[model samples]
Target: MGSKLGAAVAAVVLALPLLVGAGVAGIGSALFGGSGTSSLNCTPDGTTTGTVPGMTAEQMINAATIVAVGKQMGVPEPGWVVAIAAALQESKLRNLHYGDRDSLGLFQQRPSMGWGSPQQITTPTYAATKFFEHLTATPNWQTMSVNDAAQTVQGSGFPHAYAQHEDKARAVVAAVSGVRCQPTMAGTGDCNNIQAPNPAAMTAINYACGQRGLPYVWGGNGPLNGDAGFDCSGLTKAAYDAAGISLPRTAHTQYNAGPRVPDGSLLPGDLVFYGPPSKIRHVGLYLGNGKMLNAPTFGQPVQIDNYRYPGDDYAGATRPAEHHR
Candidate 1:
């Protein structure tokens, strides 16, 4: 049953891009502190970049385990990149046999901080989750900054250093994630599952997409709920309501409600989240192939893209009530 569920999810992923054009996406691809590829064009940063050096491939493989863990834990690619970059800055992704003094494993987690046994920290996924789980609890973490989000968790000596690796992290995410993520066509039901939308969510996603060129309003959801402009999550949420689905008013709440999607099986209409892993603060509806129809901010209108927030803090996906219908 579990394998069928997994395959069903996989089928939905494979058909999604075709369905959306269709598009959707995410995947974790590194562990705490690993060096990034640093050779691709991507969105610039408003955050810290982490990169040190001396990461062995063995350590790199460990970081890869985090990618799988992040996807499973609902951490987005952006979060994955940030976590990886921070780890790179901290331990060079080596999953160090030891830390600054007694700090052991990747990111030099301290035994004093309750990081776990040395072997656990050495396990790539264990280390990454420890980092992410800690990040999720930082105070004011949501609004602080990306590297800052990491800093709150890892508590490294360097907060500014993480930014240097942002581009590299972005590159890694692009290089590794795309190859793995394959959104399915929602409602197909075989391993080819393409679950139908409940009506309101589909309407919500389409309505915003339909108003492709409208101005983005701070709190507007059209003059009558589906016409004019919309705030970030508001635009997508209203459309979902139109489709007959009920969703919590905020992105964080959305994360709390659904079955966490694994990274490799993304699909259209999947709720993509952004912001701190510890605190989900934003969301968008996935379209497919590689695009998302969203009500971007103040100056932007609902536009299509391969991911959310130029791909920042993507905390993974969830199915809204309508999506399961």
Candidate 2:
């Protein structure tokens, strides 16, 4: 991942559009009543009900807070699932004022560990916001399994515990936000409807998607190269190679070897890059709707993730298929 090359042209700041949409309304109508306005309020208003089944009114309200904060931050539905799942495992979606050591609130975030003060950490909105912030900061988090993404942010001793709550968490998110996300380890559920720009792009995307769940083997070129999996540039190279387009072996070289895609105009199958131009380190195959298919770092497999995230060092994108044409 650290194959550095010299600088190319000035960096282009990408214009990523916010991915938001109207979710199905009244999924929680039994609890929230016909007026959807009631569910939007994160604060408990005494009229709350266990419309989600198995969860109490208070737990549902906290879940609602988590969903609301994620939407306000423009976090995609998968992120909300991760946040809510972490909350479920940590505090059963209740905003508790006590936990192991200084761990507190719905996420059991430690006040002593810089999560925030007890008062702030106990606040439902504040806790949910903090959880989402950390989750989004994790590189390629959208590609990670719900438990893996939750553990990456929470750093819990019981790392595997978060997985148990994912179904419930996803259910809570759907109930509160009315958006049913069919999240899979292979890709974010939101990207299924996104169409590739052309047959060639579609071919490349399909090729990459087929490689999902493969390990991230640095310098590996996938099964065709006789390795188990792929590296960032290796996966992109292999995907385009399947589409009959040749690309440079490393990320920096590939960035410089582009029919450079203009900023704000990325299309599916475009090769998105990260890090400075002088030392580009990461690359992924754009899968449209702000999602990408890539072999993210060691321990992570080939999977789909948002192309942009908080603290991401996105460089730019290149349309390799354009060069082929």
Leading candidate by lDDT: 2
Off by over 4 Å in 1: 1-56, 139-142, 179-325
What TM-score goes with each of the models?
Answer: 0.40, 0.42
Model 2 C-alpha lDDT per residue in residues 1-325, reported as the tens digit of each score: 0111100000000111111111111011121111111112122223322246677767766776677667656689899899988989999988888889888899898878977678767767567767777777789999999999999999988999999998888777765664222111122223344344334565688789889999999899999889999999999888888888888999999999988977876767789999999999999998765788999999999999989999999999998866543
Residues forming the 10-long window of minimal summed lDDT in candidate 2: 5-14
* Regions more than 4 Å wrong, model 2: 1-194
Residue 295, candidate 1: C-alpha displacement in angstroms: 48
Q: How high is the lDDT of residue 236 in model 2? A: 89
- lDDT, candidate 1, 43-88, per-residue tens: 2233211111443434344444445445544566667777777777
- By summed lDDT, the worst window of 10 consecutive residues in model 1 runs over 18-27
lDDT of 2 at 278: 97
**TM-score (C-alpha) between model 2 and the true structure:** 0.42
Full-model lDDT, candidate 2: 0.70
